[model samples]
Target: MAQPQPIPGTTIFDGIQAAKGYALNKMCFSFNDAGNRAAFKADEEGYMARFQLTAPQAEAIRKRDVLGLLAAGGNVYYLAKFAGILGLDVQDLGAAQTGMSKQDFKAMLVRANEQVIH
Candidate 1:
């Protein structure tokens, strides 16, 4: 099978990327449990260390930058779980990705949906 061509400024969540992101993904998945989320909030460093995240992944989590996390091998689905802990939703991440305010990104979503509907 041919490998998918890499997109500029994008991280493709291929098998290799998934392997690299395992620890980060595991940590994010733990957020599905409210107790784990509370534990992470109680001591972020301890939680990160428990997952053995790579340095870049740790930094991305610290900054709460969705793009950085994606670049560091985070899957969007898993990151969404993590974002919930920070009171952020996927729309916030979308806004950050597009360099727009949350309002603008939400508006873009609405426009796209309207186009599809019409």
Candidate 2:
């Protein structure tokens, strides 16, 4: 089956993207192990090299760019592990996505939930 046309401004986490992201995602997955997370923190470049990330993926990691990582074929759930290493939670990623401050994005989330309840 033909994969759908790429979405404008979005990198779909389809088979192709998954293939492209294998090394990157593998690296992120390692974060599940505390020792691996410490290794990453201890030597980021070395860690990325160990995973054999591509130039773009490694660049995204070096820049601490969530969006760039997504564009480089990172899956959000896996990327959260990477984010944790930087002391950023999923909410921080949400704020980045919405171009809002963390506080503002959190407020938006609360407001939206309240609307759904009332």
**Which candidate has the highest lDDT of all?**
1
Displacement of residue 11 (Cα, Å) in model 2 is 3.6
Model 2: which residue pairs collide? none
Model 2: lDDT of residue 60: 91
TM-scores for every candidate against the unseen true structure: 0.91, 0.86
Candidate 2 clash figure, as a count: 0
Poorest stretch of ten by lDDT in candidate 1: 6-15
Model 2 lDDT per residue over 2-107, tens place: 7689656566788878988988998899899999999998999999999999999999999998888988889888999999989999999878766789999999
17-117 in candidate 1: lDDT tens per residue?
Answer: 89889999999999999999999999999999999999999999999989989888889999999999989999998888778999999999999999999
Query: Could you list the CA RMSD of all candidates, in the order they appear?
Result: 1.4, 2.4
Q: Give the TM-score of candidate 1.
A: 0.91
Clashes of each: 0, 0
Per-residue lDDT of 88 in model 2: 95
